[model samples]
Target: MSNADEYIRKLSFNFTLSYQMPLLTIGAYQNPIAVAMPAAPLAAAAPALAPGQGDHVFGDVIGTIETALQSIFGGGAGWQTRMQKYNSTLASLWTALTALDLGHGALPPIVNRAGMAEPDEHSHMFGGYSHRFQWQLCELVATGFVAGPTGANIEVRVIGGATKAWRKGVMARFDDLIGHLVDSTALAFYITSPTVIRHAAALVRHSAISLTAAVAYTTGHNGPGKLRVNTVLAQYASLRIAFESILLRLENEGGTRAYNAVDDSWS
Candidate 1:
């Protein structure tokens, strides 16, 4: 073939042009090179109080008990009236401590990171015991008594509630409480019928309790009768100790429940 013929054939083939499929418009970004920004971060879904796997009763039980005992004890007959002021606070402590054992669980605090006010459950509760804890324990202790510091103040919890063991061993110790007239020197040492100090001043101090040493082996003036009150108070102290232990455990257990709830709730 001649050189001019070959050059013309190559030029004809090269004249044809390539075409692009046009930029498919991504949603609303009309420009071909729009480069869509990452969807404006989804408005962050406005944070809500999703329960976390953690303790439901957030406050301290022993701390409150310690607070109460610190305020009372050797303080006189005015003690009960004084403690009445802490009705709400003590009720909270009692509910948190007893709630778990009762299986009611506690009303966990609201955690809405969305900057909202927390919802109140007891907006209109009325009556003597204004708080939930007070109402719950009303039947348990019709006439509340001060717990004496004695013996294993925390051992009864291993077998808790209205079970046979609890009713027989722990609660039975106080079955005689109804008729006994508790005196101003509550938690004070007193003599048993056998003419000897039952929970002598020394024994209470030995048990890490430091009530005012009011009773002597000879006189035992704090109690000439109602010897059962001393026994009941000792049992009550043990029950309190047990409840305190459970409170600490529930703190962690409730948190775990909340976390598991969150995880189970999400994908």
Candidate 2:
């Protein structure tokens, strides 16, 4: 395999491992609200309480608060469904990306000077002395060409460019999904428990705050919780950087075509 082929394979693998795999666990984390306040079991015997007393008013207030909490946090069913859908989307994306044929074999060599070329100096030196030169002997080997893609090569470039644009769109959707997960998880933590908020406040150095760090602390607070939100976020961060690096490599090095946003076809 050529360098381009190897690089493409490596990038695809990195995206699968770092971006898609970790994303599968984004919804696995236990809802902090559920953990902090579990539903109470029904009492075997009801204590006789006077009407409009302290305990009666207190129970009413608690019941109202629980109802509001349920409304905000949901019952975890819808969240699970959204997660499954995102995971399915990622699986499909992986299949399409892996199936793409971005190999260097399709591209024509930049320098195609095959036939022999007798220099003017040689002709001037030997006017009548006609000397036959081998095709390889007079071949001109050039580094870079100043021409656009043409012929069959254009198809290869179009596929590559389109795939890149499609991947970018998928990435943007992925970001939105992750952001939703993070924000929901963080909100749960903020409302259900003060531990995460206190920890995050302590960690804040200057005026700027890191929500990622807050989520990480919450997930890592009591050992490795059910949700792996921190790992997902970290892996996604690395994946973004790796993706940009892959684009840079394709642009600077020859062989594989770089993304052409102007002429890209999302469909």
Number of the top lDDT candidate: 2
Tens digits of lDDT, candidate 1, 166-249: 223322222221112122222232222323323212111111111122122223544443343333333334444555443333
TM-score of each: 0.20, 0.21
lDDT at position 86, candidate 1 = 26
lDDT of every predicted structure (CA atoms):
0.24, 0.26
| RMSD from true fold, candidate 1 | 31.5
Residue 115 lDDT (model 1)? 28
Output the worst ten-in-a-row residue range by lDDT, candidate 2: 53-62
Please identify model 1 stretches exceeding 4 Å from their true place: 1-219, 222-224, 254-267
State the displacement of the C-alpha of residue 173, model 2, in Å, after optimal TM-score superposition: 8.3
In order of listing, the candidates' clash counts read: 11, 1
Q: Candidate 2: which stretches are off by over 4 Å?
A: 1-227, 254-267
